[model samples]
Target: MIQKQNPENERIKRKFFAYLQGPLGRDEKTIQKHADAIAWFEKTTGHKSFKKFHIDQATKFRTQLQTATNARTGKPLTASTMDGQVRMLKTYFVWLSQQHGYKSRISHTDAEYFNLSRAERRIAHTPKRKQVASLQQCKRAFDLMPSATLIQRRDKALFACFMLTGIRDGAAASLPLSCVDLDEALIYQDARLMQTKAAKTITSYFLPVDPAYEVCFIEWVSYLQNELLFGHDDPVFPKPEIAVGENGFQVAGLSRDFYSNASKIREVVKSAFTSAGFAAFAPHSLRSTLTRWADKHYSSREAFKAFSQNLGHESVVTTVGSYCPVDEERQGELIRGE
Candidate 1:
């Protein structure tokens, strides 16, 4: 039962999260970001009724948040961070205006004040350079990984999978052995089972990074099948288990479904990169690295289709718009090389 919430705003937030999860089709990460902003605002206002919300409350909160220093950076929060909080708040209130109990109290127009000014919005929304691991850096990191245990082998294979396929981490977590066809030399990224981005699905074949990694991919599939006894229906990257060690506390070891989440994959990635003396890169960065590689390796129509297919993107133009941004240093390198 949804308990009587807040005699104030508690009921509203739960509903908002539901809408975000359901109709919005938002990923958990996005819902969490929006939920966090609302929670902070509610806590700041001492659980005040949403019916009493006003522009003044928004202004005061914005001011307070502006002077606050980032816990990680130790500098006053900039327009960007403040802007994100404000933006989420605005959207929530706009959503609030349409809800059953709130239609009269909140106006769609009132939420407009929660917005950053035009110039501030520009600063807040500006795209920054995304860091990705280059293919060479990835290879060095993969080579450094010690495949001592089943978990270790899986971690190494996880790195190779990212470099080879450019699949998103969550989708990677949900990949099933049946979707892979080593004999056919392709992996079917079918969204019906996998948690593909925006639910887009496509088949991705191996890139030209290294022919040798092909054997590693085959071995990984074989290990899942013959040794682990995983069936075609099982996750490609199975989750490691947590059980009591000799000391009687929980210890994690290779046990079985790709992580219920992506944290384990992230942890293994950082460890491998640090071991290889390469900069730590998130799994998504592999996409950017592949895009850059395609820019140099292929030309015209072929490059477009190659990168588009690599990303599961529906259009080559969309791929270029999203990933083909040429930074100044990289631009200089390209001009100099040619």
Candidate 2:
């Protein structure tokens, strides 16, 4: 249900968003997340104006958030999620305390109440090893994806594209046919059009996976050009065409344009993995697989630096810091080997 909008709260939120965009230089997605955090806090406070904020309200909300359950899952939110919510609220309060109308009413020290206890902060920040499918497993899933219809063929090809290039899903969705260089086995993710993180344009070559994976990707290119009559400027992975059917609106075929977002690419990956009798992995996990593979294959710093660059990382540290969590099995292997 839509919460009743408070004009006072809404007006203040507009200024907050403006502050994030202008001085802070936060992106739209980041600003939106902060907006959501503010909305959640407002909801808890019965849409109370910021000018009315007090230390008691901050303390109460912090306690209430600990017991709060996810509306969708009906389970308590994870510490990391709770941590983000609290951080967002704290940042807002700090900012609120400095604002004109709120300054005298709200004290900067009151924002400290939003901080998670030390133990909770430790739990929230600890690195957890994320699951990444091996190259062999990804190839199996790609093969298992049926190509009975145009949509199936497109989905199978989409999975192949991810495996072959390790391009982020959004970049994959935004790829023009021209960006795919079949002769070079390279995908040029031009940030000029594609939604690359940090708007970094990258040239990623196909990984040293099985020949079959490359064949699948190559066949997809042929299918798009020859079968679908897609041109140089056409989207490499087009969105599904939706139309009214006998039952209701159903996907008919591949549309002639790119997906507005990467959600469909993610859905295709999840469904493909499930059908192949594997736990679903997000599309981004493919990058981790590639990273781990590089960790094993590359010994020289230059080689690894090149590997990082291929994944669009400006610095090797950024790549390793984010995706280099060794799983228990890998950790055991490393320990035993040495």
lDDT of 2 by residue, 1-338 (tens): 54567898898889988998999878899888998888878878888778888777777777888999999999998889889988988888899889888889888888898888899999999988688888777878888999888888778878888777779988988989989899898988888878888678999988776677788789988888998899988988887789999999999888888888999889999888888889898899988887888887889999999889889888999889887776788789999995
> CA lDDT of each candidate?
0.80, 0.85
Q: Which residue runs does candidate 1 get wrong by more than 4 Å?
A: 1-5, 69-78, 99-104, 241-254, 331-338
lDDT of 1 by residue, 1-338 (tens): 33333655766788888998899888888888998888777766666789888888887777678677988989988778889899899989999999887898889998988877789789878878777777788888888899887778888888878777778887888888888988877789889988888788878887777765666777988888888788888887887677878988553755555667777777787888988987778777778887878877778897669668868987887777677787779789999995
**Sliding window of 10 residues with minimal summed lDDT for model 1:** 1-10
Residue pairs with colliding backbones in model 2 are none
Clashing residue pairs, backbone N/CA/C < 3 A, model 1: 239-256, 239-257
Write down the TM-score of every candidate.
Answer: 0.83, 0.88
- In model 2, the runs with Cα more than 4 Å from the true position are 1-6, 242-253, 336-338
Worst ten-residue run, lDDT, model 2?
207-216
